[model samples]
Target: MSESGASPAKIKKLDPTEEVHETREYDPETQKALEEIDSCQNEIDQLNEKASEEILKVEQKYNKLRKPNFENRSKIIQRIPNFWVTAFVNHPQISAILEEEEEECLHYLTKLDVEEFDDIKSGYRIKFHFDENPYFENEVLTKEFHLGSTGDPASQSTDIKWKEGHNLVERFRQRMQQGEKGGTGRKRPLELRSFFSWFSDHGDPSADEIAEVIKDDMWPNPLQYFLVPDIEVENGEGDDDEEELEDEEVDDNVVVVEEEIEEVDEEGVEEEEEEEAPGEEDGEADE
Candidate 1:
């Protein structure tokens, strides 16, 4: 669909080209060898297909095994304040698309779940559960990706019913429109797009980079992301590094002052000794 809420034009005009595919002529012996190579490739493909089936069976079994654990983990995660949002924002690729408002909006997100369809290879869906918030009316928003029987990939999402004046997606669109009209403080680039748009997006699901990142990277071990801030502190990777440097500078200044004080005290004692020696010499001369 186009940005204006309309489907794209169906007609695809092909450019004129001289390129053509042609099979190369080979000698009889070479052709026989080629046929043998093709047979070998077919066998390899058959083995690959069998391997895929076995892998899917294993995945299904494990998914069943992991269900109880995931539920228990979710129970604990709900106790933490803004757990999902924190983890989502800590994710490198996911964070890139999240603007300030989107980050705040995600605070309402209570839980997140991504489920593979029964076939596993056919499709998957990501579900977002939210607390009562000002952004929208939906408690749970879902986006599904599917591979059709014909092997065509498609995506669909729950329509976000926005609360009055709280649609960040619409806000972004308005900002883009305004920016086009030469009214702007700063315009977001294509890369820094709105998160809400991503949620509602149905285009080219197979190419959805954030979806893959969340499913493969963020979902499997969200605890790592939840502990991202602590991890960074442990690694000396943030503003704390500057603070440590400042403390060192303060310690050096204190050492310099102490040394100066010791030098002054030694000079004072030397002066007192010189005065006492002069007084003793005077007393001896009088006697």
Candidate 2:
């Protein structure tokens, strides 16, 4: 105890890194328990690694099995006009990046192929096959993404052979050249660019949203999106839309009719007043 009659303050506990307590206050049993917990964690990690390996084997097996069916489906899809483009536009994720120009350009996209590399975890590639159109000269455009062991993603895409005055990516470059108010345009972020331009983009590889959408969603079940318009048509949606338009027109005309009725009522009242003036004058002359 200090001379001031107060108990001496106990030594402040420091963080493990700040000051190592060679003589740990924990009991031997507690220390041994912590060691056991670490050992348990190591075992769990080993089990998780084994489970991942098993999952990978299953994925590889199913991926190969699904290949032939996918090829057959592609052949059938070719029979349908504008199948790939329609499916893409219907996709919620892909459609977000697509604009009118991209949609029109994609009309020429006859086939789309998404292939995973042998090591599925490594990465995958998306190939777009287009017919000769007013767009770029490349009939086949392929983009590949490679994810390394360290969790870093790298991607490369085919250089677009744009015809004269047909570069979509220029839209972003142009915006950058023009220099937006906040210097954001000059930053040249890939997110602002439209569809085909995105293929050329190498930035933001981790956020390759459209590729993920194609692989995880559209590749497995594209027919669902392809049949969207057909479903709407089958449900008499066209007729319903027409009826709604007609109802809106009728509502508009009703408002116009009410205005005309008010005008006529005012005119009728003015005519009645004019007739009463002659009667009043005749009565006054008689008096």
Candidate 3:
């Protein structure tokens, strides 16, 4: 205070009686309502935490059980040659879909692979690899199907293409291409829907008519056994409550600022009244 030539601010201590009077200003009913809200929130938080812990325990148990079952299945399939193919052929629904000629071609099928795209629900690819056969020169055929935004199995667009790899007979055939038919005729790329329908029905097929047959009934569900199970996620209610709390805090800050501005204005008016009182006393003395 001596360095600045200004008086130090004094802090007033409240008496015990004054503290008691201050407590009387709060309504009991209002205080109880606030306490009840806090209690309910605490209970909800505890229950949510316990539920999350239980869910995690169940998931861990499921994974522990699932791993051994998957390992056993994999070992069995490895021991059995063409195990998946044999199973598909024996299935009543699948057997009903194949014709005599198609069944003959299917028997040459050595490998089947399915690949999901970046967005799992968006699309997938089905690839068929065959052994050396007399039907065509291509060794691998791939088909990609695009799904709708609504997660419908029926695709709006389909891409079908043949990968190049010559069979033993095809290699000899390529060497003999110097004759009158030097270039072997290129096999035309078939439309995905038409090919699957013709393969399934052994009849003339159209794009629209085959869409439901291949996408909805065939590809997705039949290959589900090979895909990993999707994990389920719970919605977080705490995040919503936190956002609401942040909004309330912002409103309280605005009210505090307004109250501070009003207090400053009232202090300025009191200073002006005190300055005028001395001027009025001097005017009365001059009279």
Candidate 4:
């Protein structure tokens, strides 16, 4: 008997159905909510996989442009020599050449100005031209050497061509930010062509497409912590499935100990009652 004097009965081992009921700790609402949340997450993951694949294609296309032996059908970028200063820059006769001819021979000069070029021996003069400025020319013509990004002595050259249309990172960031701030409320089509379009020109993305990407990247669990309004989470709400997965395993020792405890309690209560019953019989006999 328990301390409250109610007779103890064996606690029936829960059957599969009963076990399911007890184990089903989550209310229906919570379960439904969690299922929905999981579905949305799966959809997002799939979208991410698709987006990543497309990004890889874009990366490959650009990567090929950086290589010399890409397939014949691929876009070819003429492999100009890596050095910034060309043979024209090093040529002995270049000192006497006209400003226009010097650039034409070099083929990579972007800027030319007269003040930089001046009178020297052999009617040669130094000039200030940005396309290939002779920054570190020796005072003597024989010792004159041009310094540039890829030159032997100068260290300022980097391959990042900051041309007029090369602001891709900035433009993508702006588009991503706009998508986050404004709820487009549209389903984006999964189109590879759209990626090509974005690559070619930094333009405003279709609101629907941006929304789809955002949906894939957004997290429901994170939203809960952020306290974002109108966000819903479903399935095993608040119950970490990780723990439930672990608890499904039971230790034989624990079950044995609990059974032993119940048995001991039953024996102790029965012996006490038996002793009390004998005393009550003796009292009646004496009376």
Q: Candidate 1, residues 19-73: lDDT per residue as tens digits?
A: 4344356677876775666566667877998999999999999999998898898
lDDT of 3 by residue, 1-287 (tens): 12322211221247866642322333677666655665666678779979977876775676566656645654554555554455454444454433333455555666545555545445655566667675554577665566637644443222223235522233333444643222223222233221334333323222333333444454334333222122111344347778899999999999999999999999999999999999999999999
Local lDDT at 188 for model 3: 24
The Cα error of candidate 3 at residue 127, in Å, is 1.0
TM per candidate comes to 0.70, 0.67, 0.31, 0.21
Off by over 4 Å in 2: 1-25, 171-190, 232-287
Ranking by lDDT: 1, 2, 3, 4
* Model 1 whole-model lDDT (C-alpha atoms): 0.81
Error of 4 at 63 (Å): 26
Consecutive 10-residue window with the lowest summed lDDT within model 2: 1-10
Q: Rate the local accuracy (lDDT) of all candidates.
A: 0.81, 0.79, 0.50, 0.36
RMSD to the hidden true structure, all candidates: 11.8, 11.4, 32.5, 34.5
Query: Compared to the true structure, candidate 4 yields what TM-score?
Result: 0.21
What's model 4's lDDT at 99?
32
lDDT of 4 by residue, 1-287 (tens): 12332211222346657642333346677666756665666678779979977876775665456334323212121233312124233322221221322233234432211111122111211222233323222121111222322424211111222335433334334555675321222333333122212323323322233222222222111123223222323444555676666665456567888999999999999999999999999999999
